[model samples]
Target chain A: MIEEVFAVGTSRIHRVDPRHRVVFAAVFSVQTAIGKEPAALILALAAALVLVLAARLDARRVLQRSVPVLAFLMLLWLVLPWTVPGRPWLTTGPLSASMEGVRLSWQISLKSISILLALMALTATMTAATLGHALHHLGVPEKIVSLLMITYRYLFVIEAEFTRLWRAAKVRGFRPRTNLHSYRTYAYLVGMLFVRASDRAERVYAAMRCRGFKGKFYTLAVFPAGRDTVWFSLGMSGLAIAMAAAEWTATV
Target chain B: MDRTDPIIELKGVSFAYPGGPQVIRHLDFALHKRDRIGLVAPNGSGKTTLLHLILGLLKPSEGEVRLFGRSMRGEKDFVLLRTKIGLLFQDADDQLFNPTVIEDVAFGPLNTGKTREEALAISRDTLHRLGLSGFEDRITHKLSGGEKQMVAMATIVALQPEALLLDEPTVGLDEKTHKRLIALLAELALPCVIISHAFDFLSATTDRILTMENGRIVLDEEMRVHIHEHAHKLGSKPHRHV
Candidate 1:
């Protein structure tokens, strides 16, 4: 159920150092989230598109991933213009659509899509294991990094366990319907999953101790920054600076 | 330590979980050098609890665990001893927590203060020994059941431990893979305590068998090959004996 589709690639984005990609993603996301100017937001969106293209990601899959965020933005579009009090752009019956609310909604949608695309192209290009190590190298807390790594490792196992339970229920003629019986069955299934997960957790802890784990996770992975990493860092920095300049000039 | 001294010893070990019934009661056991012991029991018979107590994963309610002829009382004592005694958990998924096979195998050696390169070398050598050389970069969860079990074994073997404690090592294995595992266990020279329900597997891999019932050993005997003819009904034959 938990698959790293973007992590498998041969593009230049994949070859770039995961640490550099992570940093760039963070910087770009923060900048796009706070910036309100149309010019800067559009430029950021364009840059994100370029990143998506450079990463060689499938356009169809990218669009599929964006569907949820787009649906959320559509909800905002439905409510914002009619609710906010400002200069009326359109009027019908008792509702008046405002220009200010439309602009605000437009800015938000752009920012959200831009940030999502940027993250998908950059951070998602590396495996979760690489991301965990990169976060550790970038000074994230050891405990948090270990948590991420371990969670990533076991998500599939837990999902498989859940699947097995669900299958067993299905095989036993347990059908779901809008009734208390189905609800109770679902509740029991979830409860059983928690019980099994906790049991597995205890066994996992004991196994960790058996291997002489001393509360510190030592990684054998080494992320070597190559020429591509240097170039990627410089390019991202230049784009961010240009976006900041655009935002500043537009504000003035 | 003398050569004849028990490598692992339990004296009057008794334990009960908080607000739970006693899992183990006054259990005394010893593992000597060159001892290949199999422990068999029904579920909830304290076989696994016994192994955990010896590893210091659980503190006995009333008794002591000794390893290498030294009494172990605290977590600090088990920290150093764990590196010397490898353990294979009942579930391979619980034992392997790393993304890739090599990382999981190298975890023990890395914890023991081996350098990255040294740990990787040890992991490679261990995997090679277990006939899993090409699985270094493979995602651990993607492997088959038998493969995961072998990789779990490789993780422990990488530690170069003095002894091994295996819990249900043959739980989900097929006949061919089961034979392979038995052969692999035979190749290892270190003493081991294996927990399993399969009498045939135990007989093949262990020198002695200990049966447990209600948190106590009820039968301890030398494992011997016992072959007998069984009847089969086929075709027009009333009863065919082989």
Candidate 2:
């Protein structure tokens, strides 16, 4: 039910060390998110596009994945241009679009898209399990890494349980409609899902204990450090620094 | 511990959940080496609770749990005992918490302090032994029910546990997988306390059978299959009975 559509690949980006990808994704995302200059944002976005191409990701799938962010950006475009109280760039029929507001909205849209594409091309190229291991190797807290790994593992199980419960409801002449009864039925279904999930959590914990879990999750994954990983890290670092320099120069 | 000593011993064990009635009542049980025992019980008969108590997942309010002739009183002791006694949960999903099949299978060995390389080797070996040679990189959740069950078994067996506590191992299995499970169980030399409802499966795999009711063992007998030929009504043809 939970598909990792982008995880399976045989490209240069896929072969890079997950740790390098994770760290560079963070560095590039942070730089893009904080950068105010159009020049830096455009550079970041272009770099992200290059990474996407290098990863050989399907352009159609990438666009499909970007739909939610694009929708959010559309909302921002609708609201921001008229609300920020600045010199009017356009006035029509009692609605005025402010220059500063439009600029702010544009910057946010660029930041969001650049970060999203970069993350998809880098971190999403590996499975969640690999990402968890990478985070651990990067000195993320053990508890957080454990939570990520365990949550990823059981998300599918809980989804399957929800599907079964929904099927049972459907088989019992239960057609959801716009009514109090339907609302109550959906609430009960969600409540039961939570109850079942918690019950399964207890059983899973017991099973872990039976297998000698001692409050520490040991990962068998190894991210081998190679020349490509080193070069990728250096190259990404250089690009990130360049983006930051452009943002500073534009600010000055 | 002597070879004759019980691998797992429960003495006067009685347990109740907080604010709940007793699920296990003055239960005394022992599992010795070379004993492949099948335990049959009705729903809510506390067969699972009993296994949990033995594994120290649930503590007994009245009695003590002894593992390998040593009394295990606290969490620390059970941590060590768990490496020696593996329990296969009825739901494979509960047992497999890792993303990939090999990682899930290697989890036990890793938890027991094996190096990553050693654990991977053990996991590969275990999967190979279970006829899942090429399933190393498969996502655990994407596997079929029977395959998941076998992989769960591989996780437990990878630890090289001395005994196994299997809860309803044959549930949700197809005929072929069920036959394969029986064959696998027969091949394992470890003593097993299998809680199952399938009488024929128990008879085929175990040497001793136990029936539990009301949180206690009601019948203990040698595992035997009685076959007879019988005719139904006047004109019906005779058929072999199981």
TM-score of 2: 0.93
Write out the backbone clash pairs for model 1. none
Query: Which residue segments of model 1 deviate by more than 4 Å?
Result: B218-223, B228-242
Give the clashing residue pairs of candidate 2, or none: none
Q: For each candidate in turn, give its C-alpha RMSD to the true structure in angstroms.
A: 3.2, 3.0
Considering the two chains of model 2, state its CAPRI-style docking category: high
lDDT of 1 by residue, A1-252 (tens): 766899999998998999889999999999999998898999999999999999999999899989999999999999999998899999998899999999999999999999999999998888888999899988999999988988888888889999999999999999999999999999999999999889888888889888988889888778877888888888999999999999899888
> Could you give candidate 2's per-residue lDDT for residues A1-252 as a string of tens digits?
657889989988888999889989998988888888888999998999999998999999999999999999999999999999999999998999999999999999999999999999999999998999999989999999989988988888888899999999999999999999999999999999999999999999998888888788887777777777887888898898889889788778
- Candidate 1 chain B: worst-modelled 10 consecutive residues by lDDT: B233-242
True contacts kept of 2: 0.98
Q: For residues B1-242, write the lDDT of model 1, one tens digit per residue.
A: 77778999999889998899999988888999989998877788888888889899989989889999989989999998987998898889999989899999999999999999999999999888788879998988889999999999999999999999999998777677788788888888789999987777877888888877667675655544365556555646542121
Report the TM-score for the A-chain of model 2: 0.96
Q: What DockQ does model 2 achieve?
A: 0.81
